[model samples]
Target: MKRREFFKKGTTAAVAAGVIPLVTASCVGAKDMVYDRKQDKWFDLGTGKTGSNSRKKTVAYDVAVIGGGAAGICAAVAAARNGSKTVLIQDRPVLGGNASSEMRVHLNGVNNIKGKAERETGIIEEILLHNRFENEQESFPVWDHVLYDFVVREPNLTLMLNTQAIEAVMDGDKIKSALCWQATTEILFTINAPVYIDCSGDGLLAATSGAEYRTGREGKAEFNEKFAPDEPDGWQMGATLLMSSKDMGKPMKYSPPSYAIKYTHEGGHKRRKFAGFHEGIWWIEVGSDDDIIADFEENRHKLMGYLHGVWDYIKNSGKFPEAENLALDWVGSLPGRRESRRFIGDYIVSEKDMTEHKHFDDAVAFGGWSLDEHNPGGIENISEPPSYFHYHFEEVYQFPFRSLYSKNVSNLMFAGRNVSQTHIALSSSRIMGTCALMGQAVGTAAAICNKKNVLPREVGQKYIKNLQEQMLRDDAFIPKRPANDPNDLARKASLIFGSTTSSGDAKKLINGFSRDIDGKNNHWQSDGLSADLQLEWESSISLSYVELKCDTNLQRNIMMRKDSRNDELYFNGIPNELLKSLSLEARVNGKWIKLGVIEENRTRLIKFKFDTIKTTAVRIKMTETYGAENVKLFEVRCYA
Candidate 1:
């Protein structure tokens, strides 16, 4: 049968049965093999072409996430974990977007804010922690596989790699299905989902779905943004091709390709910098003058030429004798794009929001990166600095839920660089860490939308608090936002500490503030490693889940940096304060019963879910720490 007919049959059966239909790998040819037209009609499910290739496959899920970057990964993972069936599609063979081996741009997040490290928590941190455990060599190729491993482990998530989303089928303002093309498999994927998240970085799905969007810088008067241009313009930050070099034992000779552009110090324009050979060179940029999306192929060529020219200058020009022993190890074939189409939302984040550090009631994410806007001139103009660091905040600023979902497209949401933000505000929030948080927020929101059968805007309006509380329960931190879940039984119980007390009160455990937010004191500390914390109520409370928030030392960098030393490797390892072993027990009819026990716990936030039981009192026994001599925790909650 034709693939399209098969898909139609499968989808019809699945809808009647009220279940999702998956295209199993066993039913298809091996993923690595390219299908031949005549020999394999079943394998070559062509992309709507005549004669040989005129078939497509259809699938269904609760949420569909387009793009497999950090943001998309987090969104899909979050959505799946929150009880929604999710699908993630990436055009590339591997994930990680700029951080992948294909692009080689270092993954960056909320590393530091005002001299204090505030590493982003939740799914992004979990991925980084997993990388430290699995990818000890810190190899870029290995990192790609690590992400794949983390993603596939979620049984509720379906990942489609090497698949490009070409069309978005819409019903009114809702995205009914996203049609994708997988060249290798020659399969057309028609993914139907209730909620769709556009993490494609370029906002392709949102644009195709007719989501309202903007392309370039907004005028200062638009949002009272000081960093915006005096007048609205089409100019945007350029794309870049990152390259890396390694030091050989001896001198190395270089020969440029016939098409390589020759370079000299004069070509440097005095603005392009060549330093820190171990770190990837990120200034080989171009393509802001033309259409960033429409002229993608033309821009990539210019970026590639500029990359080769910069390398040629470093190797041939005698300006730097220190680089004689260094050899080019890698050059990215794909450009790490910076800016493109940004979908419109209920609230547009402006430069003023970032500079003034405006805290939003609906905040779901935060960013601390400085406002570093690259010059529009790119590699062609050398007179000015590569970018302008126009503004810095006193601390990290929060991103509201209003900027995540499409204003017109009811079921559509977006993350990464495509979220609803003015060009000037995007300069800071565009970092991967901030994007990851946005992804988590939107993913969780999508799950909620699926559960309630509502639109994205409805989620922000009615269930915004519920969504934020869910994120907190999952260990995601929202700046200035406190968790006040009414369902938590511990919030009403009496709290007691069994060890040395910190300056803060033990009541902070039930205060709803998990992380350190807005200089608020909402954490409890013990003087020694082994401590017992308990919550007691007058009457029996039936609970099935217990969540504990332990301190994970956010003051140190946990991510891998390109120029890190051997001694600094420990920073990527387990945090010293994390509780390695713990046990939870409840008093049933005046006798203690073990509810859950954990060993080798590596995460800052740990939750124990078991069969529901009635208990008058519950206590947490922490016997070991990752390395620290004391046990410090932020919050503990029991859910009914």
Candidate 2:
């Protein structure tokens, strides 16, 4: 059957899942793969509505994402939106990984670079912006639901919470199916897919599939890391237990739980200042010098004791009067872990790769978080700073595709903290925000892998440019790698100009960097709203889609913080620079006809889809902004 007919005649065939050979699953990740086409076809096979039926479940998707953290969410969302039938599996009831309410480690990214922020753009940015609108209160619990809503809203995505992808059913070097355990439903699910992404920080599936991975600290000579221990050791960064205290508006009595380990702070490091005591203490952590994941429970208990111990010091200790009224409001039982298994990829991203800013032709993502290697012994070693702020980046560094997939496992790709990198390199890339971008990259690549019927490594070796082009069109910024999508009709225009040139020329819109960086502007700014931008072609061209990348001040952070900080560096509210009201019209022959209008725009990458039109010129009129007096735009693209 023709592939188009495979989608059209969906109701005719039974979904005889694991054995059907998956005819149409070869499609690259595109949003139109599977859907309501067979919604009315499922026959009611249940006998007594709640009878003892088979607990084994079988489903299929083009891409299967293991883990529902920031990285996993972005990966699943990207694959689904790009047209792949995608599944996101999370072992926990809630999403957000370390940033989840249960853990609440802040989702930090390229927060600062030499006194300015060059924030990430793409799915991760969309997520943060969504949080700003839906979670202005910055409540961590509400943020979880906000993320759940975001994932469920995607028409092509399926989410399974409290489900863990425990094992990989391997076929030679590729993973044929994932044996997942849905804890809540008590069902063992067999998820079949062409591509599998292990964004799970621990990479359980990758490990079980025999993907090459390494744990523990690397010697400085291995990756030429300057900050590495003299020789390789089993020491891994610890998991942290966090707690929040709220001021009761009056003095409250203090008492220590029996499990509390006494904290005297007699020999504490000088840098361990309780700067934001009311929110939580980050250094209240514990690490394992050996078998970190194996020591989770032991570390959890110790971390809990240490948490209350520190709280006892703040509340009962006479050193500070301000914390006398502060009482514990929330405490995390699950520790947010750092450093477990570093899956080996074709290339291992080392410390110098980031600090030296090495460029990769197969670069798919960028990260600028500092080399924040936490101290070896955690809070137990109070004499040391919680982390050694090894080095900072003045500019963002490229993350290569070769370092995102397994060197041994053919079909397995990874994102999040588990992707192939040295311990020192992970210090910067492990930040949830940075991990989110990597998720989007791999997610998009997974769709491409399905479309091309190739492994992740092939996607890197041959089709890397295609992957980069797609990411760019979707609003991901690859520093120095300007987008050159061949299908972008705006680039072919004979003339392009804005109604008013204020900061950058309209011609710069096709130059391809989506955000201003390194003191160079890649966007066009209007003197005021209601400005007009036009593109003209020498002859009539056929087109149906128009995409625009607008300004959201990437130089400032929009991530939700514990303090809900809204300063110049960290912004808690929606960006005022977004173009709120815009209309698109195309010139047919000599007259102009309206195409579409967006009144309540929410995304930085604005898109318009309509019937194809033969036009010699197109005009976009911007009427208003969220708040800014002037409207700014980065790029404009059109496709048929």
Candidate 3:
């Protein structure tokens, strides 16, 4: 008999007899099939290979995070750091999903607000700082590795790479266990976790587990999102495989594959000069809305052809006279998918929430980008009113904590681009910075749930508040105002300084601290002097330190600084080292002179004592030891 016929007959008989036959070079061997007692059935056909009817050991965990993308890493780290025995399962070898080194897409967000990095913090900030240290300019691969290391290094996190979750064990509506197949070992491993997080952008876990989800655009009436189409549309933002090129001496010959030319520029729709070329770094996106999974193979081939075609066009064509030396530098191994399955969460954030700047009671993350819906054809579609437009709000809009948890599955949480949101809302929130913040928030929430021994929904408003506070404390921006406290006040002061400080003294201060001050629209200079000499400190020791004094006891809060940008204090074009040596002192004219010295290592601030200093002027003078030629005060004010 032929090999195919023999194997087919043998497999059919063995399966019918409740056994699996292993084929070997010499002979075929059969083993009895063991049913999963928990699943109450025999293994289903077409499941991934897991060896010959042998059961594998199972490990129990507190939390299981599916997918190792930006959100998954954050969730695993958060769960592990909070004392949960967590396991992170990723099908790919590398951690970053879309933003991986393989993909090589630039991390984009609202980072260019007023020319300053805005609302970017937490793990994302750590990664950027790491990038800054490793390379003067950032690289995506380095960033991807940083995320991978962060997950694998966590003591409580068990990172299982090259493992795909093929089956889920469900009890009623809850997930009891998940079965993953390891391609290398050909073994099926099971992991039991109390809580599960779907960080997979494709919503694979949710889909396989029978969790409710949505796809494509929703009708405007459903959520009242103005940008949403009047009628429900099947349109979704497309996917792309990006490529890069550098200048080479001569032009290279290139041709696209037959499948790549499926759709061409037609109906007088002119193609851009670099449309088919890959010479330019920025001009590297291609794919289609027809079915991401079905067309993925063909799309990849087309991308390669287009990339080479781009290089050829640049070098051979006369468009770029200076690009005689350009050549293909890099191309992505995997395509970056923009839209997929969106898991249904407790609350779906809508575009109306963004337009109205809707404040949620449980706001845990904020996003500021406008709705930037891409065209169905993978190329940016330009319309009359334009498919993308900015909202009326200048401030970032808040996303609630409830939206991060699933509504159908009690113990499941989600993050990243797959979080509960309409397509319009996702256009703004899908940015990496916002996704990182969402990851940080979800991680914090997962930790809380694990520690408290409660369902995600039962985690409560108080716990959400605590999580938000912790996120803000870690530098992740939430929509709510941070609590007003001495530490917060000091941090604000340090931010105002924009330079490193030691102890209580603002020592080693650089000149023109004013230039470093951020968030200041107007250019303001400092006038270093006491309004009245009588109000100054009595001793030269007190004069050694520079202090911010306030008058009229204003009811508003005051943020004083030597300069707007950094903590550099200068006197007569000379760097003043005295600001670090002396402590801050405060007094309300002869009434037990509160006389508190500036803390040894931090910015100096004396909250106005309204009871005694009402209608009085407060003075901040240096200690007597430091004498400066001319001391300038950057900013002085009192707030109620």
lDDT of 2: 0.87
**Residues 204-237 of candidate 3: C-alpha lDDT, one tens digit per residue:** 5665566666667899899987778898765666
Off by over 4 Å in 1: 1-54, 267-272, 565-570
Ranking by lDDT: 2, 1, 3
Candidate 1 global lDDT: 0.81
Query: On a 0 to 1 TM-score scale, where does candidate 1 land against the true structure?
Result: 0.89
lDDT tens per residue, model 2, 247-360: 899999879899999999988999888999888888988887766766788899999899888888888888889887888898889999988878899999999999889989
TM-score of each: 0.89, 0.92, 0.66
Off by over 4 Å in 2: 1-51
Per-model C-alpha lDDT, please?
Answer: 0.81, 0.87, 0.56
lDDT of 3 at 329: 73
Off by over 4 Å in 3: 1-57, 114-116, 137-139, 249-291, 301-318, 321-323, 380-393, 460-462, 484-640
Please give the lDDT score for candidate 3: 0.56
Rank the models by TM-score, top first: 2, 1, 3
